[model samples]
Target: MGFDEKAQNKAQEFQGKAKEFVGDKTGDENLQADGAADQAESGAKKAAENVKDAAKNLKDGLTGN
Candidate 1:
């Protein structure tokens, strides 16, 4: 994936981690769940981007681009 996407994914993961930590400290189950959801969403996004990038590379290689 590109640098921008990578950075965004990292930021999202970090935000989730912070939320989870705060939720644990504050004893908020909902916040903890939200944090976990956020991390999962970010991971999905990154995986999608990686797949797209791999597809593009495969196409380029096939076309000798």
Candidate 2:
């Protein structure tokens, strides 16, 4: 987990919202699906980052760094 990954995940989440809105407005099922997928991925990414950060913290603690 790092700043860049966090920012990218945030950006992805926003973009997915835009896509979902546009899809709803235009009645595009594919776009809506894509947006949903994007949102899911973004959520997963953030979760992964959190896990990584926690692991890093544990490592640093053991190593005294």
Structural RMSD, model 1: 1.6
Query: Residue by residue across 1-65, what tens digits does model 1's lDDT show?
Result: 67897899899999998888899999999989888888999999988988998999999999999
- Backbone atom clashes (below 3 Å) for every candidate: 0, 0
Q: How does candidate 2 fare on TM-score? A: 0.79
RMSD of each: 1.6, 1.7
> Residue-wise lDDT of candidate 2 within 15-40, one digit each (tens)?
99999989999999999999989999
Q: Give the Å shift of residue 59 in candidate 2.
A: 2.2
TM-score of 1: 0.83
Question: Ten residues in a row with the worst lDDT in model 1?
Answer: 1-10
